[model samples]
Target: MKFLQIAAIAAALSALTFGCQKKAEKKASYPPTPATLVKAEGKSVRKYIDTLGTISSLHSVNIVPQVSGQIVKINFEQGQFVKEGDVLAEIDPRPYAAAVMQAEGNLRQAEAQLKIDALDVERNRKLAKDNYVDKQTFDSLLAKVEVDKGVVETCKAALETARINLDWCKIKSPISGKVGLYNINSGNVVAAGTSVITTIEQLDRLYVDFVVPSQRLYDVKRFMEANGGKAAVDVSYIEDDLGHRKTVAEVDIILNKIRYESGTAVLRGRLDNKDGLFWPNQPVKVRVNLEEIKGAVLIPNMCIQIGPKEPFVYIAAPYKDGVYVISQRDVGEGQLFDGGMRAVSGVKDGEMVVKSVSSLRLQAGPFVYAATPEGLIMGADSKPILDPAKMREFMSNATAIADELRAKFAKEAAEAAAKKQAPVEALKAAEKAAAGE
Candidate 1:
């Protein structure tokens, strides 16, 4: 009885296994999946190199006192826009003024002595000519006149020096720009040429400084030469969270010297910041356009699939019952393009490519159909109609695929027609014999 029970259990397990196998086989015979199809198209594209860079003021100046003095007045507030030669601060001018006066007094004394010496030389010359004075005395008087002229010139130089010192008392801006914070306040003593009073930077036009490998400098220069001594550059500020960049300006790029330590060359971009969108020393994204690809074949990056050795895409050909024959063609892929498109070499213009709903389910030569929204209709409820424009585009893609398939099989179609006609002619001859024709 125990042996009979074991035999019954084994029979029941065998029946269950057989039932599961039949169900799985039924599920595997379903129809092919549908996919979104798009066409490869030609577009104008540009090649660019992306790098990080720093924004800076094109022109910056450090304001310092040319002469040491106590600051008596401050003329500019921090962060004020100033013009060239605008007075910024005032130093005490009393000492310089006194020096000017003393030099002028010395100049007058020298002039007076020069006049007396000249008169004495003229009188001695006249006496020597009449033999009343010796030639040596006349020569001595002429030498005295020359010495007086030298004293006058020395006094004049002293006066000019004093005047320059007095001018320095009023510190002025050397360039037109916005001023930074003041380092010293009024009544503070500053050292000549060493103390930092403030800083001014020109912001109407800005510079973006970036570095790239030295090998790329040649490409930069070649691009510039082709595009009128300037390569196109874009400056952008990046948002860290979303990884998006906001372009601040489009500018021209200038190539600079290479640094041997890092084997990188510095590049400077001149950006017009008349709107003050960018700030100095701010980090930004820099993109330099190296070259342009004309008539480039472009397709969405999603359409490209990796094959055993190269990248490939699925070319869709129209098949029976609104389905497509997906054939894989190897492609040479280039740089990433705008709008998530990639440049490819193997595909021609206007070829339909499949967009997979689930990339993992996609494989070479898998059957597919065009996706539509007809299933949205329900009983006793209104459904959203297909967009007219989108429907037209879908129909157009189907027509294109059909046309391509027809052209590809044109020779075979002629051969099939000949075969069909030959059989029909044979039947006609047999019918004529029966009719005694």
Candidate 2:
């Protein structure tokens, strides 16, 4: 009886092992996943350092009055584009004008008195030479003429100063730019050199200011030193109604010192804003081109997948009948460039990579079919689908296949769960029966 029981247990174990093997075999067989594939190309990829930056006018200034007086007239409309030397506002010139008139009258009076003194000195010298006048009297007359000459010079200087003050009443724009709103309106008194009248920013040319890690300072310096003291850069920003726009610029200068708190150095690029696309103090995206990688494998950024250990891409090798064998390859450091592409290592030129696999449960060593974004099966060579009827038919079939696979996978999962619970249910039933006995 004991030998028979031992043999029965051994036979049961063997059968269980066989059943597990069968399950494993069934799980290993998977349907071909549909995905879009793109061929990797070899090209020179420009490496860039991306960061947020701010737009600033090349020349910005705050307009102020040169003489203190009440504002009489505002010449410019708010937010109007103005040119250099354009009168922006006018101060009460009546006071300054009156002072100019007073200075002119004073200068005229001084000149007339100096002429009279010169005549008196000439007459007194003649009298002193002829001995008709006493020496004391002639000398006294000469001293009086000299005193009058000194007074005339003092009046001349005062008149010039008064004339200058009169010209300062008119406030003009110092640079060609758009004018900001008025700070002090007409009829308000503003102090000279202290009160701000308005602000202007030159929009024909702009400066893009951005910061990068201090470690990258050397790279930027190298690029500039090699390329005539200017490094290539691109500035991009979005408009509310116009979507996105980008413009090329060049780095003009790097700040002399780095910020200790952020460990970054500031770089300023010169950007042409003749179209007025960029504004002062506007935030923008900046890309500083450092260097180019030659003969690098380039692929669309969407093809990269973040795995548990590292970023990877699925390489697809042509198999039989429009199917491909998928193999996951771990890529090295990647640099993003324009047009949604990235330069990456570990992929070779002319190799096909899966562009998108988010909807598919994929693994290494599985077969996949190349499909378009619209789910139309592509040709074995991944050529463009030119036939409308064929695309429609394939799209319908692809949708049906996807739905069927999903249902089948769900059913299998349900069955596996049920199988796992069957033994527990059986054991519970047996325990209840034994207790009842």
Number of the predicted model whose lDDT against the real structure is largest: 2
Put down candidate 2 lDDT per residue, 28-63, tens digits, no spaces: 223557788999999887778988899998998999
Q: Candidate 1, 87: how far from true, in Å?
A: 1.0
Q: In TM-score terms, which candidate is top?
A: 1
lDDT of each: 0.75, 0.79
Query: Candidate 1 residues 293-315, lDDT tens each?
Result: 89999999988888789888878
RMSD to native for every prediction?
13.0, 12.0
Residue pairs with colliding backbones in model 1 are none
List residue ranges in candidate 1 displaced over 4 A.
1-28, 213-215, 240-256, 260-263, 357-365, 372-437
Model 2, global lDDT: 0.79
Ten residues in sequence with the least summed lDDT for candidate 2: 1-10
